[model samples]
Target: MLFARRADWKATKPDNLHEPVTSTKGVKVHYTGTRFEPFLEVHALCAMRVKEIQREHMEGKGDSEIDYNLLVCRHGVVFEGRGWREQNAANGNRELNRAHHAVCAPTGSGGYTDVPEKMVRGIQDAIAYLRRHGAGWEIAGHRDGYATQCPGDLLYGHVLNGSLDPGVLWDGGNHIVRGGETLGRISVRYNVPSDYIILANPDDLDASGKVKDGMKLWIPARGVPLKGADPTPGDDATEFQPFPGAKWFHEEPSSPIITAMGERLVAEGCSEYAKGPGPQWSEADRASYAKWQRKLGYAGAKADGWPGETSWEQLRVPYVGQKPGDFEEFPGDAWFHDQPKSRIITAMGKRLVEEGCGHYSKGPGPQWTEADRHSYAVWQRKLGFNGSKADGWPGEYSWDRLQVPEDDD
Candidate 1:
């Protein structure tokens, strides 16, 4: 991992800043908003993006320094910003500022088109590194908890798709109702068919395709790629189902379950996604699942998402952020104590952070060292553990206290 430190990017030191905040939630993915040229070289293009974003955050946004905690360049290099253990000004509100770290990816000259594969990997790597340390697992977009579209549509789809981790708010349909807003108008706004909006909220629409002045709706994402074209579909069940799924792309967020599956796959080290394991099942999921199946000694028809009961039973795992599951081996302190750094250790660290028991100099590193033990010990002490129980290793008693949720549903 080629990590560019603060000096490497020529970032200005934060001045006049007081009482730095720590994020207890997860991370937020931000985009440059404005378009830039496609990256030809990592050093030149990435550095320019870092400089410009920092300048805008400090000068225009009126912050002490850059808003984000890091920037993932298009060539898969992670540029440090406020670094870990500091507050991010880019996360919408003051409370959210204290809850989440911010990371930015550049979408370049055409605004939210296909971002480079290297850049997407870099973003995921940065998130993994943060998860290894002490960041929470709730990955979100800039506009997820805020109003403005700072991360754009295409990139935000990945955020919804669980690119970083779990707790992604499903996208392409959250909109506020305003005065004179009709089902047709809302459909136009989100680029979805009016029929989708009607299906998302049947009771809210009027007979003439009108809408109440103050009725909120989950407008499914734009189905009709053809702008100004008739979205009129025959009254059929297939027409009501959101995206045209005669074909599926790995790049779009379509549903909640797909996002959950993607998150689990990412934590399991199957990152074949460029955009999402978001709302929709894409080529990424198939490719990732195929790798997993390949690892599991499966061949031919026993690959990808089409799995039998035996495959499902064998591929069990504990969700990092979502609801916990019945794993044959629950990753506990033994998995972390003196054990090598891995995804299990990272998940445990994220849970530790959520419990407000992190105490590492830099981060909850992937390495199963003294830091992770001490952090868990802190939480154990909070649970009134003493003597052997407070030895900084996770025990069932303390693990239960942490209440790691299982994504059973």
Candidate 2:
């Protein structure tokens, strides 16, 4: 999805502003943490909220724009907040403001909500854009750097688990085969199961497993590749490598190892072919790798599939730096609890109730009251469940029904 640039903000520039110090310390993620009523004008509401945050910051409370350097809406639209070179007051620490880049996900009082997949991809794209333009480091979510639940729970989990795999084709559609493509070749190229390719392209195959060239075939965007035995003699020997060093590519954040593998593959043929980060990998890189792999007689010459270790070793690729999944630090699981609760708790409670859980209650504190019971009932009903009258008693069926697994153990 393409993002429309914020021309209005681009037209205005601050005077004599000191550029922020760009360091690779960490990335910070945040939530707008404001209540957004449905059916209201979204853009206007967001603009108003941004203004309010600016007012609070300028009143000697923080640096002047909304606390984040960028804001992502539920609809997946990205808006500019603070300039990259300017300090932001959104995070509580001034020192962090100088070193960290901030990005905000739109959320209400709820800690975090469903972030549109497109928005997540857009965030990755923005980070890549920033890095290419010399923002000085890779991207990270707000929870990564500080103790807070800013980007929402689901998204935070995606980043933590390395599952989101930003920068790949995410439209989740089917691809049609062009001329000069073979099923076995295409299947290996995309890491898609051969059966999946066959099933998707039923019209092209005969009983003998023959597929004619130029036949239209349906290929699912996200599918697992078929694993094969090691390439035999005369098989292409080119391997997959990744970009060198800790440099971040805007696309494919999840599989850094593959990127490194691709880099090594190129280096094997021509040392000059392996260079440091210049821009996001282009079709040229894919074409070059394909040429090398084909010349080496490797079966996996196409650049459309996820890379595995076998692909790397067959092409004589070396693992570079830390393996893709390695990380030295991570914010503790209870990070979200530290964010000011003015909006998060209320929103999360309401969401829980809306999802068919009833009588939602906050933690293990002793402040239970009739008001809490009433709120719980309302939340339950909103979630489309039958809620009983307000009853402030622990172990009540409604209370039990409403409990969510706590992140803190």
lDDT for every model? Answer: 0.60, 0.45
TM-scores for candidates 1 onward, in order: 0.39, 0.37
lDDT of 1 at 336: 53
State the lDDT of candidate 2 residue by residue for 275-384, as single tens digits: 43122355544555555555555564354332333443465432222233232222222433243333333433454445653453443222433444455556445433
- Residue lDDT tens for model 1, 1-409: 3467788666778876644654357788888776553222323335545766777677767888888888887666678888776787778778877778888886643633566666775676577556655778788888876897778877888877765442222235467778777676665565444544655555666436667666677654321112222212111100111221223333344544355455445545566888535555667777876777777788887775554445544544212221223322446444555578665565667677877888777766557878888887888777665665487766543554455434312
* TM-score top scorer: 1
Q: In model 2, which regions exceed 4 Å deviation?
A: 1-16, 22-26, 40-52, 59-62, 135-139, 163-409
Top-lDDT structure, candidate number: 1
How far is 358's C-alpha from truth in model 2 (Å)? 55
Q: Which residue runs does candidate 1 get wrong by more than 4 Å? A: 21-23, 39-42, 108-112, 166-409
Q: Which ten residues in a row have the lowest lDDT in candidate 1?
A: 233-242
